[model samples]
Target: MTIFLALVVGGLFGFVLDRIGVTNPSIMGRMHALMNLAVMKTILLAIGVGSILMFGGQMVGLVDVGHMSVKTAYIGVFVGGLLLGTGWAVSGYCPGTGLSSAAGGRRDALYFIAGGLLGAAAYMVTYPSVKAMGLLEKIGGGKVTIGTVPGSGYDGLTGLPGDVLGIVLGLVFVVVAFALPERPRKGEPVPVAAE
Candidate 1:
C-alpha cells in the first residue's frame, strides 16, 4: 500500500513538474539565470504550504513527531549541497526533475541520470576512504532541527519553538512567491525548448 501510494504521488509530482515547464532544461537554465521565476515561485509555494501543514499538524497533535528524520549536519553535507547545485546548474536537472524529464521523453535527461548514477557509485566506492579522512565526522553531534523537539537536546540555532518558526518562515515564503513578477522583463527572451 505504501509503495502504491508512493507511485501515485510520484506520478502526480512528475505531472505537475511537466505541466509547470520544469521538465525543460531551457526553462531550468533560464530560472538559474534569473530570467524566469516560475520554477522558483512554484518551489517556494510548495515549501510554504508543506511547512505550514507539517508544523500545523504537529501543533494540533495530528502528526507523529517520532517519524520525522532530520539529517546530521557536517562539512560533507555542505560540500555535497554545493556539488548538487553545481550539477543542477550545469546539467539543468536535479534528480527529481531529471527523472521526470526522462519519463517525459527527454534524451538528455537520460544521460543526466546515467552520470548521476556513476557519481553515486563512485561516492559509494570511495566512502571508506572519505570516512577515514574525517569527511563524515559528526560536528557537535550533527543531528538537529530548526525548532525544539521533545526529549531532544538540539534546539537549533535560535532555540525557538519549531512549529511557530516553521509557520512564520512558511508564510514568508508564500509572500515572496506571490510578490515575484510573473511576466518576463522587457527585451527578455522567453525560454523555449529546442526542436
Candidate 2:
C-alpha cells in the first residue's frame, strides 16, 4: 500500500513537471543563466510544502523520521556543486531534466543527455580507482541536519521546523514572481511576426 501510494504521488509530480514546461530546454537554460527564476521558485514551493507536511505528520505521530543518506562534505563536494551549477548554466539542463527533455523530443536536450551518459559511464569505469584512492569518500562527513538520528527517541524538528524556513523562503519567490516582468527570448524580436 505504501509503495502504491508512492507511485501515484510520483506520477503526479512528473505530470506537473511536464505540464509546467520544466522539461523544456529553453526554460531550463534561462533558469541556469539566472534570467529566469521560475525553476528555483517552483523547487522552493515544492520543498516548502513537502517539508511542512512531513513535519506536520511527525508531530501527530503519523509517521516516523528515517535515516538520512550519508554526508560527504569534503572539498570535492563544493567543487562538484560548483561544476554542476556551471554545467547547468552552460548546457541549460541538469541530468534528469536533460533526459526528460530529450525524451520529449527536444534536439538540444540531446546534448545534455549525451553529457550525462558520458559522465555516468566515466564514473562506472573509474569507480574502482575512485574508491581505492579514497577520492569518492573524501568528503564523507556528519549527518549535518537539525534533527536527531532515527530511533534516538527524538522526533525531527517540531513546530517552526526546517520546512518553516522553506515556507518563508518560498514567499520571497512568490513575491519575485509577481515583481519580475517577462521579456522576449534573445534573437526573438518582438516585432518579428509583424515585420
Candidate 3:
C-alpha cells in the first residue's frame, strides 16, 4: 500500500512537471539564470519537512530509532554527490527531472536521456564484474543516513533534536527565496502563472 501510494504520488508530481512545461531546457536554463528557484525550493522544503517529521516521530517514540537507522561514512557518498551535482549544473536537470523535460520536446533533453540510459545499461552490464571482483568492497557499511547512529555514542552531533534547526532553516529558506530578484529573458513571454 505504501509503495502503491508512493507511485501514485510520484506520477502526479511528474504530471505537474509536465503541465508546467518544466521539461524544457530553455525553461530550466532561464530558471538557473534567476527567474526560478523551483527545484531548490522544492527540494529544501521536502528535506526540512522530512527532517522535522523524522525527529518528531523518534522523539515521541512513534518510530524506532534503532531498527530504522543508517550508517554514515562519506567517501563514496561524497564523490557520488559531487558527480550528481556536477551533472545537474551542466545539464540543468537531474535524471528523473531530465526525463520529464525531454518528454516535453526539448532536444538537448534527448541527448541527456540517451546518456542516462547508456550509463544505466553500462552499470547493469558491469554489475557482475563489479561484485565478482569486489570493486565496492571498500565502501564498508554502505547504508548510512543522518539518523543511523553509530558507535560515536551521541557526543552532541545527534541530529535527532534538530527539527527546530530544520524549521529555522526552512524559515530562512522561505525568507531568502522571497528576496531573490526575478528577471525574464528578452523575447520570451513572461510566465505570468508562476508569479
- Say which candidate scores most in TM-score: 1
Give the range of the ten consecutive residues with the poorest summed lDDT in model 3: 147-156
Local accuracy by lDDT, each model: 0.84, 0.62, 0.61
The digit string of per-residue lDDT tens for model 2 on 37-139 reads: 6666676556656656655555566756553243644555676789898887777677767777777787988877777889889978987976686555543
**Stretches of model 3 off by over 4 angstroms after superposition:** 19-21, 33-73, 105-107, 123-156, 183-195
CA lDDT, candidate 2, residue 20 = 75
Q: Whose lDDT is higher: candidate 2's or candidate 3's?
A: 2
State the RMSD for candidate 1. 2.6
lDDT for each residue of candidate 1 in 22-83, tens digit (9 for 90 to 100): 88988888788778788889989999998899888878888876667778888899888999
Give candidate 2 misplaced runs (Cα > 4 Å).
Answer: 1-7, 67-71, 128-141, 147-195
Q: What lDDT tens digits, residue by residue, belong to model 3 across residues 21-54? A: 4565556665666556564455555555655565
Candidate 1 lands at a TM-score of 0.86
In the predicted model 1, the residue pairs found to clash are none
Ranking by TM-score: 1, 2, 3
Residue 109 CA displacement from its true place in model 1, Å: 1.0
Candidate 3 similarity to native, TM-score: 0.57
